[model samples]
Target: MQNQGLLKELIQSLCCLPGVGPKSAQRMAFHLLQRNRDGGMQLSKMLARAVNEIGHCRECRTLTETELCEVCANPLRDAETLCVVESPADVWVIDQATTFKGKYFVLHGRLSPLDGIGPDQLGFELLEQRMATGQIKELILATNSTVEGQATAHFIGEVAGKFNIRATRIAHGVPMGGELEFIDSGTLAHAFNGRREF
Candidate 1:
């Protein structure tokens, strides 16, 4: 029975992943043990290696295997402009979608006081130290549109302002090709308010 021994342990272990329930984990365990043992072994090895070796970048706090992330090490990237984001995943998304040549600072999460997450937890001390260096000319707040994200951006903006560095927030709105009729009201309103002269 899956509840009795190693199968139970495997299922419980897989359930640690986001969105993976007992049933889903059980299915995955069964699939791996039955038809894809080699693939499962590969996955296990890779996962272990990634977990053990991957670490936060020294400068930007993004996931990396070295002292600094590729962006931070690259000479071509603009060091004067830095994009601040909520997570390491945000860095990947922004890099692939935009032509921005600026450097990045991964916050890893926004401010959420209720949950006891503060600037210290999100590496704001490091960010402040970077700002104190005066190498950065602009701080781009690319945080999410949520209330917590907005508050986090504002807090960082204030910090940048104290150092005379310009801070700008990323514009939020509807998708590029989305029709107004199908778009959600909140996004539509935000888009209208953010509109500028073409």
Candidate 2:
């Protein structure tokens, strides 16, 4: 019924999260209600605060509560090398997994015309402004290995060319411990084509 109470409303609201189907939402909602209402309340408060306070960093467009994100704010970070990624989460993941000491630019998404996402939506103008500042000597395209990601990187590379900035793509190939026999043909081809002297 449209007039279902708070319990139903809570379950429906929980379904808004990614990968959270109705069953998952229901389970979560019931778990919170039955066993951990206090934890749920705490989570609710934190989530509310994060959503309400978090805003994009002025320079990199990553989610931050301040004018600049930690990376952009750090003076020790390399201003000459900027990594372009598809999401704020990518910035976090790359920082955690790699030794990249350069800055980052979060695109939030790739160029997908069918979904109506374009350069404007991804804040290409802001990126161009950063490039125009003449500080970025190299742009590292760390976007996903999908077709749209490649197209986005290509478009950004062309933009970098206009500013005379060097652009490089992060390699997408076999994992460090992946066996050649088990690796897929596409990955093998990419790795073989991208091979360099030992």
Off by over 4 Å in 2: 1-4
lDDT of 1 by residue, 1-198 (tens): 435788888999999999999989989999999999999999999999999999999999999999989999999999999999999999999999999999999999999999999999999999999999999999999999899999999999999999999999998988988888999999999899999999
In the range 1-198, model 2's lDDT, one tens digit per residue, is 586699899999999999999999999999999999999999999999999999999999999999988999999999999999999999999999999999999999999999999899999999999999999999999999999999999999999999999999998889999999999999999999988899
**RMSD list, candidates in order:** 1.4, 1.9
Steric collisions counted per model: 0, 0
How big is the positional error of residue 191 in model 2, measured in Å on the Cα after superposition?
1.4
State each model's CA lDDT, in order.
Answer: 0.95, 0.96
Best by TM-score: 1
Q: Which stretches of candidate 1 lie over 4 Å from their true place?
A: 1-3
Worst 10 residues of 1 by lDDT: 1-10
Sequence-dependent TM-score of model 1: 0.94
Estimate candidate 2's alpha-carbon lDDT, on a 0 to 1 scale. 0.96
